[model samples]
Target: MESSDTTVVRASQPPPVQHEFALRFTSTPRGARLARRLVSHRLDEWGYGYESPVNESLTLIAAELAANAVQHGQVPGRDFRLRLTATSGILRIEVTDTLTERVPPQSVPEVPGDAESGRGLLLVDRLATRWGTCPRSAGPGKTVWAELTDAAAW
Candidate 1:
C-alpha cells in the first residue's frame, strides 16, 4: 500500500513549473520528526532528492522550525501545520503552532561553549534565505516561516 507520507502530483494537462503542499500534524516530538522526514521524501519525489544543496538546506530548516514548534509552541491537543510552496525559483516553508504567546526569541543568546540548548533559530538564520513570524490569519497562534531560493535552474 502506498504510505500516507507519499503524495503524487499528476497533471491532466501540462504541469506547471511550480507546486505546493501543506499539512498539519499533532504537536509532539514524533510529529516533528515526521515533518522533517516527509519534507525530504516530498522533495525527493519533486526531483530534488537529497543530492541538491537546496534540498538539504531546506531539510535542515524544516527540522529546526518543526522542532521549535514541538518544543516551544505545542499546546495540549493542538496540532502544528507545515506548508511548502514553490514558485519560480523560491521555496517557502511555514510552520504554525497553537501557542502564540510563546513565540521564539528573535535573537539567540550567545551561550558558553558547554551550553547544550538554544541553537535552533541560530541554525535557521544561517541556512534560510529569509525567515520571520506572523500572526495566523485564522485566529490565535503565529506562523513561523522561512524561504529558500533554488540553487539550480528551475
Candidate 2:
C-alpha cells in the first residue's frame, strides 16, 4: 500500500469592519445639548456603551464643539450642523455653523485659573488625535472637525 500525505491550508481571516455616521443640527444651546445626547446614543448603538472611554470622549467632544458652534459661530436665521463618522480604527466629529467671519481663535488664550470660560477647544486638543477647522463648501459657514483613533477598541 502506498502511503499518502495530505496538506491542509486555511485562508486568512479578513480585517475587522468599520462603519460611519453623520448628523446635522441647529446652532443653539438646545441644539448643542441634543448633539451631545445624540452622540452618546449613537455610540451606544454602535456597541460603544456609556461606560466605554470612546463614548465618553465622543460625548465630551460633541458637547464642546456644539457649544462652540452655538456660542461663537452662530448666525441669526442659520442653523449649525453636527456630524459623526466612525470606522474600525477612527471616529470623526464635525460641527458646522453659519458664522464664517468669526473663526475660533488659533490658540486659546491663557485664562485665570478660576475663569469659567475658554477651555472647550483646549479639551478637544488634548483628547482628539487630530482637530481643525475649515470653511464649508456651501458658502458662508465653517466646519470644525476632530478625529479619535482606535475608536472601536477605546
Candidate 3:
C-alpha cells in the first residue's frame, strides 16, 4: 500500500461585524428627547433588549449628551447629529453640535447637594466605560463621545 499524507488548511477569519445608526435632530429639547428614544430603539434592534443594562445605560448616556448639545451647543439654524456604532464588544455613542465654544469638563465636577442641574456628565461618567469630547471631523462643532464595552454583545 502507498503511504498517505494528511494535510490541514486553515480558513481565513471573516471580517468583524459592525452596526451603525446616525441621524440629525433639531437643536431643541424635543429633538433631544427623540434622540434618547431612538437610541434605545436602535440598541434593541441590535439585539440589546430594552431592559438590558447595556441598553439602559446607553439610552441614559444618549439623553444626557443630547440634552447637553441642545442646551449648550445649540446654534440658531444648525441641527445636532447623533451617531451610534457597535463593533465587536464595544458600543460608541457620539453627539455632534454646531457650537464649538462649549466643551465638557475634563474631570467630573462636584455638584452641590441642592443643585438642580450639572449632574448629567457625572451620570455619564459613571455609566460609560469611558467618555470624552472632540472637534467634529466635518463641521464647526464638537462631538462628545462615550463608549461602553459588554462582552455579551460580542
Writing each residue's lDDT as its tens digit, candidate 3 over 1-154 gives 8999998888968446599999999999999999999999999999999999999999999999999999999999999999999877889999999898999999998899999999999999999999999999997999999999873753
Give the per-residue Cα lDDT of candidate 2 at 145: 92
lDDT of 2 by residue, 1-154 (tens): 9998998888977444465566777777898999999899988998889988889988999899999998998888888888887756888888888788888777767667898898898898888988988999788889999999887566
lDDT values for all models:
0.85, 0.85, 0.94
Could you tell me the TM-score of candidate 1? Answer: 0.84
Cand. 1 Cα-lDDT: 0.85
* lDDT tens digits, residue span 1-154, model 1: 8767877898667335477888998888899999998888788877776868777888899999999999999889999999987776788889999888987677766667788988788888888888999998887899999988764453
Error of 2 at 14 (Å): 18
Clashes of each: 0, 1, 0
TM-score of 3: 0.87
> Which runs of model 3 end up more than 4 angstroms from their true locations?
1-17, 151-154
> Candidate 2's error at 20, in angstroms?
3.3
lDDT for residue 66 in candidate 3, whole number 0-100: 99
